[model samples]
Target: MKFDTTQLSQKTQTLSPYSRLPTPCSLLPLLKLYNKTISQIVKLWNH
Candidate 1:
């Protein structure tokens, strides 16, 4: 239920260096897109 920034940053360090981009932004819409895409993919697979 609670989000942890330290854990997330540590996880992302394994993937890339931090200086390449801006910091985090509003993610509500990004999560919506992710949910939509997942459902769409599931529907495609079922069809």
Candidate 2:
């Protein structure tokens, strides 16, 4: 089977989260905050 580079590049662009977001670095802080919130909620639920 022959591989198409153009098709592969397009697929990569579509699949990449960095391409969809305006700032890739922004996701890290938001993810950390979300995790902290989730853990705090779980702790409260457990108590």
Candidate 3:
């Protein structure tokens, strides 16, 4: 379950140079929204 930087870099290298990846800035909102949804789900299960 460890995060593997080498594996990530290898995958990225296989992509076309013109392909775009989401920057951290773009990912932040998605991460926040995902967290909020998980929190709500936990609350419902706890209820």
Best by lDDT: 2
Q: Considering TM-score, which of the candidate structures 1 and 2 is the better prediction for this target?
A: 2
For 2-31, candidate 2 gives per-residue lDDT tens digits of 999999999999999976776758778998
lDDT of 3: 0.89
Q: Give the Cα RMSD of candidate 2.
A: 6.3
lDDT of each: 0.82, 0.91, 0.89
Residue 4 of model 3: what lDDT?
A: 100
Q: List RMSD in Å for every model shown.
A: 13.5, 6.3, 12.6
- Candidate numbers sorted by lDDT from highest down: 2, 3, 1
Query: Model 2, which residues run further than 4 Å from truth?
Result: 1-20
How well is each residue in 1-47 modelled by candidate 1, as lDDT tens digits? Answer: 89999999877886676555554565677888999999999999999
lDDT (10s digit) by residue, model 3, range 7-46: 8988988785745777889999999999999999999999
The total number of steric clashes, by the backbone 3 Å criterion, in model 3 comes to: 0
Better of 1 and 3 by lDDT: 3
State the lDDT at 33 in candidate 1: 92
